[model samples]
Target: MNNLKYSICFISFFFLFLMSMMSMMFMIYFIMNNMVIFLEWEVITLNSMNIVMSVLLDWMSLLFMMFVLLISSVVIFYSKSYMSSEINLSRFIILVLLFVFSMMLLIISPNIISILLGWDGLGLVSYCLVIYYQNLKSYNAGMLTALSNRIGDVLILMVISWMMNYGSWNYIFYLDFMNNDLVMMMISFMIIMAAMTKSAQIPFSSWLPAAMAAPTPVSALVHSSTLVTAGVYLLIRFNILLIQSNFLKILLLLSGLTMFMAGIAANYEFDLKKIIALSTLSQLGLMMSILSMGFPDLAFFHLLTHAMFKALLFMCAGVIIHMMNNMQDIRFMGGISFYIPFTSLCMNISNMALCGIPFLAGFYSKDLILEMTSFSNLNLLIFMLYYLSTGLTMFYSFRLTMYLMVNDCNLLSVFNLFDEDYTMLKSMFILLFMSIVSGSFLSWLMFNYPYMIYLPFNMKMMVIYVSLLGGFMGYIISTMKIYSVNKFLVTYNLSNFLSLMWFMPYLSTYGLNYYFLNFGHNLLKNIDLGWSEVYSGLGMFNVIKKYSMMYSVYQMSNFKIYLFSFFLWMMIILIMLLIGL
Candidate 1:
């Protein structure tokens, strides 16, 4: 059985790698030749209109598929080592493969029906993965994740039903029709909402962190590339419709706030995996906001680059977590660089890449995004969100670094920590290389010409200045002072509110749920058992029984009085007859 599982993992890794290479080749061909292939198979005809299943093969789709495959390939390989102790290793591997397949289906399809299939697949498989540990936290997290994504699934279903007016579900073909028709554009709103829920933006953002209850390998895959990015990818495909729509502005505001919110929240987070998860959420916001600003390409660029490094970061964290005996608190982790230098080095590199350090994978995409933001004629709110979020990214990244690398060892004097797992290192090395180089490689390959930007020197350097300031603040804040009072205690409530993702989880879970459940309980008490009983069957039966009993007693006690009354009535009638005569 063990040998069979190993073979399954190996076969999956090889198959994914092969597919990735093929996807890249196709992506390049499609790009060079400026080509797209659309294949449609007619499923049925109604009212002289065809319902067809369609596949869209183009540069963008192929490129995204390539990245997804590459990441999944390495992730599956990484899991072989990371999940080695698990009894159901083969099942886990198969679930990951199914997830990648779903994503691929989503990437290639032009029809909303096909998209729904893949979208639902992702949600279902992810729930399985999240609840894999069979614990309360995992179960709760899985429920949140599944139900949150189900919102998107429902919205897509609505979109499909609405699209029926056009006699087709191929969204790519009818984007223009929907763009011109006001009533049709309502689908765009639903689409945006669906995407937001899937991406976990703003009000729907609680599930992303909750999802960290999954295995680290799943986190590395889902948070970084496949699951979360599906929403961004969907929007990217629909960018043409959004570019001219008024709803894009709303998306921009929400995405910016999401970016800012996640950034601030991460600074207050202590769980190592959750910090990275929040960072993923922040970057997702960046992608979404940029896409909303009418640059799907930049969003796509950042999405790809982010997938590389963020996956590496999670893999590194998994190694650390594994070594730390499942301890995810950064407070308990400090100065293990000496023990596991390779893992530490990889983590630092991924963290720096996350901070958008110069010339690294992130810089190539992140710097471009900020420059584009500066160039665009956006409002002050959005402008501040962009820069402030950038600084907070650095702040949290450095704080994390200090806690994990710079500070004194907080663990016991003796512990075994080493980077000797060659399988894990090999997988990390693939992502580590990609994390360093994928940004520049993709930028050069994807863009034939550079964007023109004329910015003042101060504005151009704003990212650097903020990054340095954030780094300084992060270092200072993480530093412990024995004599100093705890600031978090002084501002306890405020800290809790901010740290707990603005109580979003409660709002999404218990807040709304409590009210709804309370309403049901009230109905049970008042209507089902209270007023309903009084007005209907049981209460009415009691009333009728009481009245019947009262009449029976009156008849039984007053028989003689009744006879006398009858005789008096007859006598009065006879006297009236005589008078008439």
Candidate 2:
């Protein structure tokens, strides 16, 4: 049975890798010819509106599909080793494949109707994957993830209905022409809201970290390429309508806040998967903000490159977690690099890439993004957010590295950690290679000309300066002995707020549900267990019991009362007969 599951995994990997290569070839051909192919099938027409299913074959979609397939292929293969002992390995693999298929549907669809189908599919399947462990935490996280994305699903439905004004659902055809129309602007707002929810920006930001309840393989695929990026990809498709628009500014501010918030939150986080998840959130904010700034190409570039390293980061984390017997806390993980050298190498390199180290996958995109932000005419707040968030990225990355690799071992005395899982290591190597070189390759392929980032020396060095400062702080902070004073306790309220993502999770869950839950409690008191019982069951029982007791007392009357009643009846009968005569 285990062999069967492994065989299934290997077969799926083989097909996915083949498809990824094919997608890459097609994307290259499309780029060379500068061509987009749209195939439409008419499902029906209603009230002069043609409802058709569309497949858009463009360089962007093909490129994204390639990356999705590549990561998914590697993740599935990794799962063969990571999830080898599980009884439901086949079920888990099927759910992941379903997720990938959903993303593919989303990528190819130019129509809002089709997009919603894919959108809902992603949400539903993600909920399934998030709760794969069948635990309370996983259940809660799955609920959060599903409900959050459902908001986007609803917004997409609104966009679909609104698109009826154009007599079609093909948003691609209308996006360029409807920029100035009021109705179209409303549709754009809905689209942006939808995108924000999927991408977990601002108030919707709580779910991404909570989604860490999922298996690490799911995280590698969902966080890195498929689910979270779906929103960014949608916006990239609709960037023409959003550029210079009023909503774009709002998006910019919110996304900036999101970037800052997630970065700070990650620094305070201790869980390995969640820290990576928060970093994913931070990078997502960068992509959204940059996209709102009217550079879809740059956002797409970062999206691709970020996928490469982030996926590898999660895989390495998975290997470490497996070795540690599911110990996810960094506090308990020190000097793991000494035990698992290859996994540590991948982890450190991915961390460096995440921090935008020079010449890595992240550097090619993230550094250019920073330079572009500096070149643009932006306000001081957003500008500071961009750079501060960048520093925080380095801070947390370095802190995590120190905790896991540099410090002394904090695990139990008799633990055995080794790097002998060839299947997992092989899968990680694919992403490791991509994480190292995909940045420059994507930069060349995506852009016909490079961005001209003319900035002052001080401005050009801002990223490095902030990064260095963050790293210094991380080292100083991590070096503090555990026996020393508890700084977090000294500023308990503030530390708690920052660490809890400004209590965004509470706001999303308890804050939103408090009134409704209170109302339900009242209903239970007043209706289900109160007034309802009185008017129906208890009241009816009381009435029946009262009548029964009264009748029994009458029946208990003596023989004299029975004889008098019989004579009275005879007299009444006689009187009636006389009157009739």
Candidate 3:
């Protein structure tokens, strides 16, 4: 009976996903006819302070919605089998449905408030799913992710409050008000902070690696495709505002630092999942840096290609881990190609794509980013940092692939090659197809007459050759086991510095909390504690004495006690009012 209910819920969610995609597709067609001018709708609604429900479609949003639907469908189907063996199947299905519903809402939100609502919902449901294992470490990781995301959400809320105070809560209002440089800069900074935290940039990134404790399918879903991508989607959605802000340079710097730092961390990890987790951060940093250059089209292209390859890597890794009895550390994996040829081949294809080998998806997207950086007005030092990080990306991509598949003395002896469940292999093959084909399809679409000029870089033979050399150099270095202490010193410390940058935002948050606490204390100082005295008169002494040993540590002077008593009374009143008492 419970299984029947779970099946019904799953089917319902599947139907909703289809309906949402169809609606978005209709919007795309409507926009192509020029029936909807998004800019005009934004301006008109700005002048009239009314919330508009009209769909104003654009290429980027449409593309993002398409990927969202694709990833969600795959995840939902994968979850059916992944969860079937669990006892609490109904609860798991509900959480999965909630995640999909929230993602759809996020993709379609037309305003900042609606976007934030969806963002918060997605974060909340993702946390629940991460802790679905109901173990200590999973719960800890979920709590940490929740705490960091909550900080970001509150920052966004503050930005919204600032916008509302300035009378610009809609995109139309932003068009009118963005001319004020100060307001635009502040909003841009806040939005970037929200994006960085959500995308697991720098210090906030530890939670992502920790999240590998989740079920393999959940990792494939949240880490590879949907939830983390929301950050990049938000940045793309507000590209116009970002372009106007002076913060683009800062965004570029942060992205470079994040990429270099995460690349170093990836090198130090032995766990296969954690290596991929760190690589995701580095790759995302690369994408964000590219987007920071005001090229939405290139950024989205990279995003699309990255999704394909990253998903393939994670799913194939899952298959291997499952085959080997859930052993994920690379130290215990070796010569896997001999046993699971199909899985190894799929991983190698993804590895080549990830490292940007010539003619692959990564070569197309990453080479464009590198070429764009060369033309930017950014300092040469910054450019070199990104260049060096790209080399590291190639290095670790080779390290992960070789350490698992190649026949070496250090390789584990007891590796298994077969995936008993064909479901996993089928998912892997689908991703493999996408990884190989997406780049050419996108290149064809954008290189045609109408959009040709918008193509940022020439996909020439020279660029491909250089990228392939970089990747091959990395592979050779890994295979030869070259030990360079100088490389270690520079890269490792850079990562620490980037990780330390997270403290700035955290310190800001702490100061804000302290100020609010102080203000609350001051506001409650004049309140009387007469009710507290009354309650204390009724056997309260006996109650206190019963726990005197524990209460002793909390005891304070008479004035402090009076302040605490007054604050307690005020809280009770506030709670009463909030609950409509």
Candidate 4:
């Protein structure tokens, strides 16, 4: 009976493992032969317009699918232990598998219709996963998460409409031809908007943090690997069209801001999962910004590596939260390594990789990205945002370590601590191993011929400088108690502004609807219920009837004949002339 809980995990892991192995095999063959497989099944054709289902197979899709399957396999294995106590364990695994399927559809589709199918599926499935716990927090976060992605869904639908002008919904075929077309301008703008919402860029980022209300496995899968990266993946596939555009410039700016703001927000966050969620936001910004820099390959490289470690980080957080009775407040968690050595080991490595520590999965991609940014012709603001965000990455990584490792035991009771679950630890170790090696493996595999980098020692030192400052700040911030200093209390306003994510959550959700809602209320009060009625049949009749009754009173009083006759000729003439005209 107990073994039944692992049935879904076992099947999913076995299937994904086989898929990953096959994808890897195809990846090698495609790289050597430069081969692609294209399959299309027409859904309908009317008046020379076509909508079809498609599958595009190439080195990129194969490689991405390989990683996706690999990660899903590991996550499913991990969930066996993570969700063992839940009655509906099979349902949770099915949702995860469904998410993986949606991602797969997205990864391979060359048709816009198929893309939307996958895109909407991701949003829908993720919403279900987010609100799985059936609580108010989960429900609200689920709505936010669902609605934010729906914006992308809507934009894609609009793109489908606009693309109808081209007589085809397969965007891949039109990328190079439509690069300079005037009609493409709207399409490009909509695409960027869609990508921004899915990637959780500025003003659309509230959902990412709020989505932490989901179970940890959902967080690891949705935030770290599949759902969020779908936008970046879409952009990557459409890179030829987007490479030369002002939209990319705007995207570059927003991505930089997202990275910077999310990093700062993470430094102030107390909830462990929320902090990790914010960190994922910061990294998403990095990928988007780099992709905007016209290097989708590098961006994709980082995306794969970030997935490995970030998933591991969340899994570790899940383990900690589970151990601490599902309490995710980092303030109540201190020196936990003393209790769970294995979990702590995994957590520290993941945190280190997240900071782009040398020789780790993050190092290969992150260091390359920073160097590339430095070499680009960027304005001062963007340059600062990138560097500062990088430092903040290190800062928060250090801060998280301090809170979870360096402080005294902060748990309410020590007797409840346990981390001996092999099911969970086994799943985590798989990701941990990947986190250590995935960057190096992926870098060598993707870029067998390395590009040359020419720069002075000072120019190269920028990342190091920011990282050191960030680490120092993280130590100080995490080590110092918030109530310990009077100065911190004095600067509460400024701190609160940054801490509350610059009120971005408020701005994106309630703030966005406030004006529209107020306008609707005013319309209902003054227009629909008031002036609309007055202009309608009964009200208008009442108005005319009152005037007519007054005139009747005058007529009855002998002055009526004179008063009516005074205005009758001109008014009657005007009405007769209007009717005749």
Candidate 5:
């Protein structure tokens, strides 16, 4: 009976999601018809179409929305069974529905304000789900994640303010703000900061691995389908801004750094979920780097393909973890391929897609990224870093897979091998099917279709061979336990260094806090704690300070003074009005 209830809820939520997608499609069709005259406001000076406001509806937005719907639906299906045993299953379902709806709204939002509203909604729901465990540790992780994302939100709000002051909030008004160099620069930087935070770039990324405190379904949903992809989607939405600021070069550099750092971090992680988490960051960085080169189509292609394979991998990991009674550390897992052939096989296929093996989904998208790097006259050092990061991806991907399935001597024996849940297996099968086929179809649609879609440059045989060699060498090194060479290579140390630098900005914020506190204390010492002295000089103030009941009242009233004072009231009202608008 409980199973039936769960199934009913899952199916109902999925149906609503489908309806939402259909509605969005219908809206897109209508919007496209009036694309050239969709004015921000119908001016009253002349109620005529002559004052037309042009809005462009290219294939890129359509493609992004399609992928968003596809991944959201799959996540809902996967989570149905993955979260079945949890006590708050109903609450989980509600959050999942809200997440899908928010993502859909974000993707098709025609104006910046609508986009931000959807973005904040998605961020809030993600925070709630992350802390679903309700433990101290999970709660802390959720708080940190929310804090990092709020910083991004602040940056986005600044951009919105710039837009309001110059261009209309509608994206079609980009041209109007293009001439204002200072505002354009500010907007560009803010958008990039938001993307970095959303996508879990470097220092802002620790929250991702911490987020593994949530259920596997939540990890799969947030990592592959909805939350992190919001950053990439933002880049696609603001492609015009990227092109205008020549910010692509800076983005490319950051993406390369993030990719390299994440790949190295994945190697040090023993937790199965953390390994996948770091890999997600690396893959996202690669896709963002490709997009930064002005190839939105390539980025979208990779994003779609990555979602399929990564979701499959996470589902397979969930099965293994469930069978092991929630043991997540990879060191405790080995030689289970024979026990769970279905999962092992699915994992292998997904791993192939992840590592960009030829003829797999990852191969097509990764090849496009590599091809782009080869053709562009980017700095040779930057190109080398990109290539090496790709190699590292192969190493860590197969290293985890090999540890689980291949190393017989290291196998962690399974006592209850047949204890697999039917619903979980069913979800895994669905993901496996999609992981195998989605890539080729997306590639064909992007490159071979009769559209104005752009393709990155093709690589020659030599470049392909070198990339293959690098991938193979990485795998060989991982297998042979070649630590000495790896140590000398400095990739690991470099990753740590870069991560430290990436985190410097955050650390500096704390440093500033420390400095201010110390400075305030010093100033107080120089003033001889004058406030206390003043209270001591006045008999009534001194009596109140010494009296326990009076001190309690003072403490209680402190909060009121902090919040309800005249200046604070004005600030609160101003903020409320801004948000309301």
Candidate 6:
């Protein structure tokens, strides 16, 4: 009976998945006909400015929405078996539904102010999802996730304020006009900063790996399709203004550094989800770098394709973790492939796709991205970061595969490892199909023409060469016999930096805020508790007490003081209204 109940819920999401597929076909047709469907309702107009609620249905939004719904449905179905034993399954389901709703709102919103509803919703919902397990790790991770994203929220608010100068918050309408105006550079910079925080770029990246405290399905959804992509999508939407700014060049450099940093961090990571989170960060950086390099369409293409494989990757990890009794450290995970061959197959396929194996989903976008990067007029530092990051991706993928599959089984001997979970497998198979074909399908649909590559043969095979070297290095490193594990002890400083993600977590959490915290403490002690109390609460009371004592006899006829107080109160209100405080 419970199984039937579960099936009914899964079927509901499956039906939505199929409906999205059908809608995608029509959306493709619409795009082919050069048609865009947009709707807007003016909510407020004041001082010649308009605040409107709007949704734009062009190829981008429809296609992104289709993929998001498809992934959400699969995730919802997969959660049936994955969370079947949970006491609060409804809470999980409701949270997932809310996340999907928030992402849909974000995807459809064409106005910055309207998008904030989705943005804040995403942050709040993600925090709820992350802390769902009700443990210390979950609590800490959730706080980090919420606070990191709050930075982006604050930036978006600043963007709204800056955008008011144009008399409208509908960025799509003014993007072209704003592209030519150097005066709007601050708004563009704010958008980039906000995107960085949400996308987990360098210096703001620690929260992403920390967010692995969430359940695997949430990780798959948030990291791949929704939360992380929100920033990239925003940049894609605002690409016209960004492309015209010097900030784009700065963004390009930082994004390349982020890709390199994340790839390197992934190689040093041992936690299954953290490794995958780092990979997502790496890919976010890739998309940002490519978009900053002036290819927003390609960035969006990669975004969709990455979603397919990465979600599958996390699902496979969830299966392995489930079978292993929640063991997540890769050091304790080995020989899972022999016990769970189906999951192993899915995992390998997703990893290979991540490494950009030809004809798979990742290859369709990633290879093209790298090719474009190479062809662009980039400096050696940026170019090397791109290629080295590619190699590092393969390195970590191979390392993870070696640890999880090729090594001896480190799990308890008494455990029963089954390769069968129809619910989980059914959802995984959905993603596997998309992971295989979504890349090629999107490429065919989105690009009417291919890019021209004039690179030499050696440059063309650069990724292949790096991939081979990375795979070889991963093998050597994963082996306990060949290389001494204590080599990191000798190079402890460098290894520690990479292992700790350049200490970004510490920096973001404590290092940057230490002085502020101390300063706040001082302010609390000296001003808040002492000076503020003296001046406002007790001190003002004493002053008024003394004055009242002095004026007790004179107050019988003093209406001027009352009149003065009334005028002062009115003046304060008028000032507040003027400044919008």
lDDT for each candidate structure: 0.91, 0.93, 0.71, 0.90, 0.74, 0.88
Candidate 6, number of clashes: 0
Cα lDDT for residue 354, candidate 1: 95
lDDT of 4: 0.90
- Once fitted onto the true fold, the runs of candidate 3 whose alpha carbons sit more than 4 angstroms away are 1-55, 166-168, 408-417, 446-581
TM-score of 3: 0.76
- The residue-by-residue lDDT of candidate 5 on 101-183, one tens digit each, is 78876776657776787789888988998899889988877877788788888887887888877536676556444734777
Candidate ranking (TM-score, best to worst): 2, 1, 4, 6, 5, 3
Error of 2 at 457 (Å): 1.4
Give residue 544's error in model 3 in angstroms.
13
Best candidate, lDDT-wise? 2
Assess candidate 4 and give its TM-score to the true structure: 0.88
Worst 10 residues of 6 by lDDT: 481-490
Q: What is the lDDT of candidate 3?
A: 0.71
Query: Which candidate ranks first by TM-score, i.e. highest?
Result: 2
TM-scores for the candidates: 0.89, 0.92, 0.76, 0.88, 0.78, 0.87
Sort the candidates on lDDT, descending order: 2, 1, 4, 6, 5, 3
Candidate 5 local lDDT, residue 475: 63
Give the C-alpha miss distance for residue 143 in model 5, angstroms.
1.5
Clashing pairs in 2: none
How many clashes does the backbone of model 2 have?
0
Comparing 1 with 4 on lDDT, the higher-scoring candidate is: 1
Question: How well is each residue in 142-211 modelled by candidate 4, as lDDT tens digits?
Answer: 9999989999999999999999898778888899877889778888888889999999998898899999
For model 2 the local lDDT of residue 100 reads 98
